[model samples]
Target: MPRARVSLLSLGSVRQGLRDSIRHLQSSSARASSTSPNEVEHSDFATEVEINDLPDGSAASERIAKAIGCSVNDLNAYFDPADPSTLSITAKSLKASPQMRTSLLEWRQNIPPISLRTERAKKAYRRPIGLNAAFEKALKVLTVDKHEKYERILRLTDKVEGIINQFNVKAIDEIPVQKKRSEAYLTAGLIRKLRIDAEINFPEVTSQFEMGKFDMRLPVYQHLVRARWEKNDRLLLIDRMESMHVIPDTLPTLYPQVDVKVRFPGTNTFWIDPGRVMSTGVTASEPKFSIQMFEDSTKLFTIVIVDPDTPDLLTDSYKTTLHYILSDISISGNSPLVDKANANELVSYLPPHPEKNSGYHRYAVWVFEQPNCEPLSTEKLASFDLQNRDSFDIRRFSQLYGLKAVGAHFWRNKYDSRTESVREKYGLPQGLVYSHKRYQHYEDYAWALPDLEVGDENKA
Candidate 1:
């Protein structure tokens, strides 16, 4: 048999013709079954083809044409305005030949109906027009740009992961202290270099670098965290401290190098926002603290919490009252949590209970780096008492102890429903309710009597 002539007709026309032939075959078989009860039923086609095989376009069309003993060009002509008798004869021949019916059924099964194709596939194959064309082109350009950005981010992330993996081979604690410190410093420098490159080259995508494995000790995360602090947290801290007078009121001036976070355990588990107004009930318990030290080397530090607005009745002014003090706190970049067990508690925590009439009181939390990492002498530690805590002088205390202020955080507290209970719990004196002193009117005073009024000459 001659090879099927290649047809210029679309695949759609070929699929519709195949479907019509299959339908005709099915109807013819049903009619034949009704007419002759003695006729043996044909077995169902055994040749199974997957839907995926239908797209072998031209090759599949050629095979189907050859199986049917016809050319693709002849199949194409069946749809043309030709003699109706010729089309009917061709249909009858297709229905009579079992091989032709099988081939048509197989083709119909493998090729999915047009309605079954996905909308995405339809869009992909469909030609765009006018504004739709422009939109598709723009979409393609955006996809390519996004893909390039994603690849760049992946490369940077891979570099970061490689650096992290190099040092992460050994447990951080197992390493020798000296070697660990040196390695930490070196890793920090390398990570910082990469971070700088990312910021300069792709500032918008720099945040993508922080997507994976976050280890605070690893410089990869640490540097990013530090950058975030500098850009956002640090500025907020300074603005609150200065605007709220936490700077001059508690300490002379503050330049925070480390990040100090404080949270009252019984009240809030999360770190409290700086300069927030907290109620007495929430601030009743001793606060837990986390201090992030940028330096690698461990250093002894002191933490002090003072209420600068403590009421001084006799003086008629406010005085600094030391509410809590912890000395000799060993802190490093890796070890941030304040371990109360190891630190010396110079003064135990005293919850803030501002009196009913007293205004909002500033509770300043100050962190001072101990000079030479020397523990405070027992004499000095013992000297801190209720008497000493009252009217506390933080500046003089820092000077005497050679402590340099490194970090500070504070919040305001005022009289609330729980203040009375807090005062009673601490066995403190009952707060006095103060009122503004009343002044006599000039008309009511004896010195301003109408009879004692000065004459015009006296006025002159």
Candidate 2:
């Protein structure tokens, strides 16, 4: 059984400790730091806890909750949300092992603000302002390999044909916006039809588009694959759902129990806290884990680790912030991540480290079974190459390549001193907290593991 949690900072000292920690931080850097691993506030944490930039306690509490992986409700149970000590105490309550707790502190300290990150994005990517988003999306969809592109063009052709058929006639005298949409769809449909015709070279239409013939058609960017999120509803404990069919339900049984362990620079590796809230420092590299397979060695698998919470928690406006994608594996009776060479790693595993002051996030790993296709063969998997990672949709990716959910699990991570650095590395936005104190209705219930044949592995 997991031990009952206790706070290291006393209530009487919390207020004072926070202030002292803040002052100590301001002396070190322009930012303010507040959390400590244990009762003793570490100087390393002082550099990372930047409360000075935060306007108030509401902001501080939100940051504390996210940084330590506790609900605002949980953090408040120990101290005022704004208090820096709230983070330290809340982490204590969660029983985060000492080494992981310290890494959380360090990770939080290293975070950079939006201004800096935006600046970094501008300098690093040099994304031309007038590059045309809609055109770019269309180009991405159209220019892929023959197999995938053929299917996409067909799907688009069908959709546009239906829309065009809905309009009894080409009402050229319609309003500007309406006419624009109609013409674009008509033109997009025409282009798809034309692409198949050997006589019409690609240059004619593209050259005409460059010359401003049916310019609106350039904006025809449609997602080819849209699959259901069957697992999101299970994660929905909120009183109300903002959008239906956005997230899926959670699986009760993590069929093949996966043990995810984090290696700390300070201490020995430990089994991840069953609760899954982790410090940013501990997540810099890909996590090492051992999976218990169901004696099926022939199956090929794909593992996608994604953070669906970005910019905020309630809605996935930013969609999934992909961290890792390892595909095409031959499970040899029970070997851990095999053949680093054979697997298709679309995105190298960047660890989860949410920005400071952002709401708590859910970082999940989804495992899909490539039953029919030779996932190992690059020739077979060529159709699945998504040129851009921004549009990566796991559900679509799974359905597109005939992969089904085999086994999956996820852990949570929030901001820490090293978070700023991680965010800077990924060119992410600064943490944003719209409101204070997310409810703790589910609280400790989130970690309930289902009973399996190996019963002992069920517990974290």
Each model's lDDT comes to 0.63, 0.47
Tens-place lDDT per residue, model 1, 190-212, is 43454334333232233344453
Q: Top TM-score: which candidate number?
A: 1
Instruction: Compute the lDDT for candidate 1.
Output: 0.63
TM-score, cand. 1: 0.53
Model 2 misplaced stretches (Cα beyond 4 Å): 1-268, 312-318, 337-339, 376-387, 425-460
Which candidate tops lDDT?
1
Give TM-scores for every candidate, taking all chains together and pairing residue i with residue i.
0.53, 0.36
Colliding pairs, model 1: none
| RMSD of each candidate relative to the true structure | 22.2, 32.9
lDDT tens per residue, model 2, 217-263: 12121100001112332232121111221136332233322222233
